[model samples]
Target: MSEWDSGKNDGKPGWNDQPAAVADASEGKQSRQDRKLIDKLVMSMQVEQRRSRRWGIFFKFLTFAYLFGIVLLFKFPLGQGLESATGGMHTAVIGVDGPIAADELASADNIVSSLRAAFKEPDAAAVILRINSPGGSPVQSGYVYDEIKRLRAEHPDKKVYAVISDIGASGAYYIASAADEIYANRASLVGSIGVVAGGFGFTEVMGKLGVERRLYTAGESKGFLDPFSAEKPEEVAFWQSVLENTHGQFIAAVQEGRGDRLADDPRVFSGLIWSGEQALELGLIDGLGSASYVARQIVGHESLVDYSRTRSPLRNLVDQLGVSVGHGVAQYVSEQRLELR
Candidate 1:
């Protein structure tokens, strides 16, 4: 760009005197045009420089956000919200833990993390899953259950029990079923042995609103779950088959976990929820006991320790901020930069 600039004079002296009037007049007009052109070019270059700076800042900000906000900041929460500092002793009580997402709950977020911290202690006699979840993902619940099974297998002497305070239906119960024994209050709603995927029927809504759904995909089932389109019969069948397969897996796991403890009946897998007392009759749950009773009986220590991450308002805000940013990136990537609504 600099080489293109003709030094603002194009090899001419500061001022010319020995020239004809016509030559001088033509020269002046040409010089004026040249100056205007130079001014416009300089202005364009400055605009481009600013644009480049903004792009640089954008990339830099995103880089910092991924490093500091997502990765490093994510771990800081775990350290900041330690169970020891929260005054939990003897028995560990793990709460809802996280959003119940698969990867987060199992590997990075909550469930396994709580169990790990609890079991790592030398004095931890018995670990309790103080579950209060309406349930979320089957994948996550299965992972949590398997992890507990693994942990229990590794430490065969230790007892892992689940005490549901409120709701422990579906996936929550799936994990709880793997416990050595399950306890819940009489009023707690337990069991919803099923899988469900939800979405809106925007086919009619979009039709009425003159909205066009432009979903591009490479696989047959790629856009099958698209909310904007009417579900095809084959797609519905495919999903139903998938749901049936996953539901079978859940049932098998429960059967293997609870053995003859769980009553053999259709209602168990009928997607029906029952009170804890009712579950006991059905053999879905073993007994009615709170965290206190479990600790006193199983752990032999009356004290408690909340191995689960109980975050403060400030800590929660940071966690949520990181979560929202990560979710945005994940959503963007999953949708391939497309959004339905």
Candidate 2:
């Protein structure tokens, strides 16, 4: 049979046989071209993978640099933050905000310690205390008040004044009254000559739920204010006496610090709060002004050295990152507490 009609499916012998010597070289060249194309494609993929890894490394370095910058923010000195263009005069600000808590004060581990160090600066013309608080522990507030008084007496020529940003009530006002001059915005809240103790009444709900409060105490009134138990009338009277005594002390402090400046108003100590404008007319503050205005107009400088433990970069970053999440958690907890019957 002719090779073309062969039963086996093999190619025809004439066509399938290796190329003649003349055309053999061309076949070999074609095979090599195919192999080269495949090799080139493989090499390109490898190069792209390496480039991608290089890009990843570059981004990692950039992240590290950003973290380093955050660190530098906390490590730098006070005067470093302010620009030099504010002129030759340099004023210092000691911000006492948040609560009258021991941690936030001018004590050993508090704002006061930071101020003590900052006030030591020779070039600072005046030290301004920026107070923004609703008041807290009377003892803590009194501690800060006494320190400011002592510092002013020591630094006679260097003016140490206060500028209440928003709310400076009760204990906060007690401290502010000690300042050489108190300044506040027209809308800033100024005074609340009062003391308060707060707690929830859960006795009715506990009865509804058949929740019996069991306790063993050596003292007769040990758990006096416990929510699960009905509060006694005598205990109520005793607590009222305590509040009245504390309120009296708060009133005396304000009167002593304000001296002849305060108006002769019997209702000033009736647990009432006043706005900054009303406070000024009542002689609680020397003037109505902001920190910047007070500095430029009175102290004559926009430059200020913050006498606070400038937060660390790591801490600041954590605060920035955690603020939203922390707030959400706190809000949820508060809502749950509010929902409880």
Candidate 3:
């Protein structure tokens, strides 16, 4: 009561007597600043997210373009499928490159189709089989040889020539023998007229490792040449007889194809290879020339057109993507096969 009466410094405001309006105004300013900072942070995050999304879309498009380019390249290679468009007289070239097998690029089905196409084309002056291989399956080679002969018989006016490059031996030569005349470079290797069947015997290794082999078969000779089992002398002799029969068939085909042009040399069919020069002397080849030289000098046609069968674009894509790995592995592990190598 005494302090009130004194009025505490005559109307001056004390520390605990501050006005409420001033405090409310200060708090309102701070709240507005905090709201502005939060809004700015949210906007910045959205901008960063948009930038990342744009980059992702751009990279996706780039990847798609790359794959599309690859597909186009596989679909249309240089100098392929131009025979129909060219529509003029040219030397038809059928390529028999790599291993001659049922599943290979130089397969019987592919080579046969190519021959038919070349023969059917009216603009084709002559057919040339361009061979470059180490030789593989005898069956495939036989099929190609028979097809070539039938095609030649059908179109007697047109001739089929075989031009070997690098090394064309065994199954490759088998196919070449069917041609009207065969040619090769002077240094090229020619003629490995033989049949071969080979495998590894793992029985001793398994026995040493204490590994038991349990193979089930329906027939007695079904597992005759199995690698895990002991090889019997009788089985080996039978296998040899089969090979000899195949070799005889091969020799007969060569003799029939070459006729009197082939020389009576024992070493020609002794499963030995010879240089192209030596081959010409032995009558294995008609002349020393390349595909172009044969086409220009022999066929009298300079322009060349490829009629070889190739894989489809879709199949090529699948192979490039490694989709056929399992199938290839299964084939590799299936069985032993006979080859003309």
Name the best candidate (by lDDT): 3
Please provide, for model 3 over 99-150, each residue's C-alpha lDDT reduced to its tens digit, 9 standing for 90 to 100: 9988888999889988898899999999999999989899999999999999
Summing lDDT over every window of 10 consecutive residues in candidate 1, give the lowest-scoring window.
332-341
Segments of candidate 1 deviating more than 4 angstroms: 1-76, 80-89, 102-109, 212-214, 318-341
Q: Compute the lDDT of residue 52 as modeled in candidate 1.
A: 100
What residue runs in model 2 are displaced by over 4 Å at the alpha carbon? 1-89, 103-109, 323-341
- TM-score preference between candidates 1 and 3, better one: 3
State the lDDT of candidate 1 residue by residue for 1-341, as single tens digits: 34234333665433333356669899999999999999999999999999999999999998886566555445565542334543444776777543355434323257788788778876677888887877767777777888889999988877898998888888888888889999999999899888776556778888889999998899877786677788888887887797788888889998989999878688888888999899999999999999899999867877777677544354456667686687758754553211000
Evaluation by lDDT, superior candidate among 2 and 3: 3
What lDDT is reached at residue 324 by model 2? 56
Error of 1 at 242 (Å): 0.6
TM-scores for all candidates: the values are 0.67, 0.69, 0.78
Model 3: runs farther than 4 Å from truth?
Answer: 1-81, 313-335
**Candidates' lDDT values, in order?**
0.76, 0.73, 0.89
Give me the displacement of residue 278 in model 3, in angstroms: 1.4
Candidate 1 local lDDT, residue 142? 77
